[model samples]
Target: MSVSSSLTGRTLIVMPAFNEEEAVGNVVREVKKTLPGTVVLVVDDGSRDATSAVAREAGALVATLPFNLGVGGAMRVGFRYALENGFDNVVQVDSDGQHDPAGVPALLEALDSADLVMGARFAGEGDYRVRGPRQWAMKVFATILSRTSRTRLTDTTSGFRASGPRAVALFAEHYPAEYLGDTIEALVIASRSGLVIRQIPVAMRPRAGGVPSHNPFKAAAYLGRASMALVFAFIRPKSIYRTGSNA
Candidate 1:
């Protein structure tokens, strides 16, 4: 897909940080390097470390949350900020530096035709292998999401994505609040609300610093909660978030 320069300055890159002090600065710098003039906002999810300071020093805006809200909650805050601040687009990137900044252009370019564009690691040209219980859980969740939403998505739990105004508004109001929630549940919400969702292939790197957010040990618990969220998403009535509703 050809990338357009229209959303360059208007887009807001939302990076949710949780004790990612070591990686936040570099991540912010990398995003700015990839997408010049784009606004990078780091949502400090009640980090005990210097994540906020580091992000701010790295030439990005920072919104420090009062307490830890996990990835979903932090992303909701970023969405709200984007909505209130008059951004035309929003991209979700992990602060741990696992998500490739170079993919932001593809996601933004895909956003021209899609309300939401997911940077899928597994669906891409190269192989991004997942092993153990986490892999099993991801496959199961992907199957459930694809079957229910009727959209074939290879990476259901991927955090790398870009959202147009329609999706940003919807998610800002009622995003998922569960532990392993945001990415999958938000897609379901977007699909139910009549927004177009698409996925593009993107490469992912290992976390630069801090521990991986989800591991095999937590896979069982994540699967349970995520299953419940998926079920509720399907059962819940569709409510489209209209443009300018929040204005």
Candidate 2:
């Protein structure tokens, strides 16, 4: 796809941060450096630290939640922000710095043909590795989601993704807020809603700071929860989040 300069100019970059003060400031700056004048909003997900201040210090618009609400919750606020602010695209980037801002333009360019475009970590560009039960769960989830979306997806749980106009409008109303729902179950919602989904190769980076959300010991439990999230997503009624127009 040919990338248009206007595509990135009008896009909204939503970085969901939870106690990521250590890296968010520099991440925000990096985004500004890479994207150059694109609007970057940092949704401070109820961190006890000065995440909001740090983000603002780095020249990003900040929205603070009263309490922690995970990535899904923070992203919902972002979608609504984009909807209200005239942005036709919403890109979710992690503020902990696992996602490179430089990959964002490719995601937006993909919107020319897809309503949702994911920056895939396992699509032959990144050396990012996952193992054990978590890896098992990811492969299973990817296989199922690939079939459901009718498009192959190598990284079903990647946090780096962009939503086009259709996805932005739909997700603003229906985006999930549950554990593991943001990426995995969220794609299920988009698929069931008849949105086009696709992905492109992108490099993943080491976390700039903050604790990892999961670890090896939690792998078994993660597999179970991940399966449940996918199941619950498929079973949800369309009317729960759709109007006739969006449906």
Candidate 3:
């Protein structure tokens, strides 16, 4: 689906960038090409590099943070922008060029019914290559989250995702402020809120330049911490969805 035809309401592509000056421009350019009418927002997470300038030159709206905010914090800023600006949809893609811009159409298509559309590298029919250990960890984490949420989720750690207005509001209101665990937390929150979550297969590439933020040991630790966090969130007797006045 072409961006113009698929999206009647406004859509914003939010790129949380940290020192990705090398790839930020290209990523923004590709997103513009794929989703012509969509606005692009690059949340600069206090990078010492030229990531913000490059993104601006590429025609993306740059939101610069004074200091380093992790991925979740950056995304929260983007989500708040989307909400305050009245965007109907928000799509998040990494600035490292690991996520293919071409697959954005698949996500937009899946958003037809779902409140959130997630790209699953493992479940989709595509050439997805990940380190063996990281792949195993993702699978295990997905299994645990699915059982805990009472909803099957194929990719709980995927950063490539699209969110509709409801999700935008949800995230803007209650997004986790630290780390990269918001992907799974969003899913669990959506399920509990009775919002529909869908997944599609999208091709993924290996990191284009620097190594991933998490190494094997770090990935394991993040997985463990994220699992515990999800369990705690699920057990807490609180609804992420607000009541009538707030909604």
Candidate 4:
């Protein structure tokens, strides 16, 4: 079947947001504008602001969590929503607007050959650079994950990604909710589960609005947390999903 065939009426954009009211609405609009008729589901991870209302006004389907579950929890909800609603492809986009909606098609198009496709920022596409311990940690994790998954992955910490049918089904049942689990550990889970993983170069932007998570001060904390994420990923067992067509 054609790659476009897999995407037709079967793709969903899942934005797991927390306290991103300023950018969520515009992000939603951009997704809709870029991919007309596509369903954009904003999983509001217990934002204290009017994120839900803004998202609705921008023409996105909002799912509000009672409390913040971080990116991993919110994403599991997205995967489940895709499964329940007959969507065969799930694309993860950051609500902070760092992930360009324009790059989504390329990621989805790569789904033609792989079960999971990630948008890699360091693949010579973007000038978006990280420094200090965060950069060191990302490089180490990427090298290890590239070996683990048996594919070269330059940006394992990237939040921009797309998952095909089998991946959606598997993640719905088994995606992790721990810190850094959504990005680093999730790739490990997919790789161990026998999913075909691939990544392409894409440019990321400075966050539209909000405090940056990575900085020199927090570099040490990130290194420690990232190391633990890898440990947890290795200890976690893998599985196969044979539940049906989606699987």
- The TM-score between candidate 4 and the true structure equals 0.93
RMSD (Cα, Å) of candidate 3? 2.5
User: How does each model score on lDDT?
Assistant: 0.83, 0.90, 0.79, 0.88
Candidate 1 total steric clashes: 0
What is the TM-score of candidate 2? 0.95
Which should have the higher TM-score, number 1 or number 4? 4
- The lDDT of model 1 is 0.83
Give one digit per residue, the lDDT tens place, for model 2 in 128-207.
98898888888998999999999999889998999999999888878889999999989998988899999999998998
Candidate 2 deviant stretches above 4 angstroms: 1-5, 244-247
Candidate 2, pairs of clashing residues: none
In lDDT terms, how accurate is model 2?
A: 0.90
Q: Pick the candidate with the highest lDDT.
A: 2
Rank candidates by lDDT, best first.
2, 4, 1, 3
- Steric clash pairs (candidate 4): none
For model 3, how does the per-residue alpha-carbon lDDT over 23-42 read when each residue is reduced to its tens digit?
A: 88988998787777778999
What is the Cα-based lDDT of residue 56 in candidate 2? Answer: 97
Instruction: State the lDDT of candidate 1 residue by residue for 119-196, as single tens digits.
Output: 888985556797866677789877876765677888888889999988888888877767666877787888777788
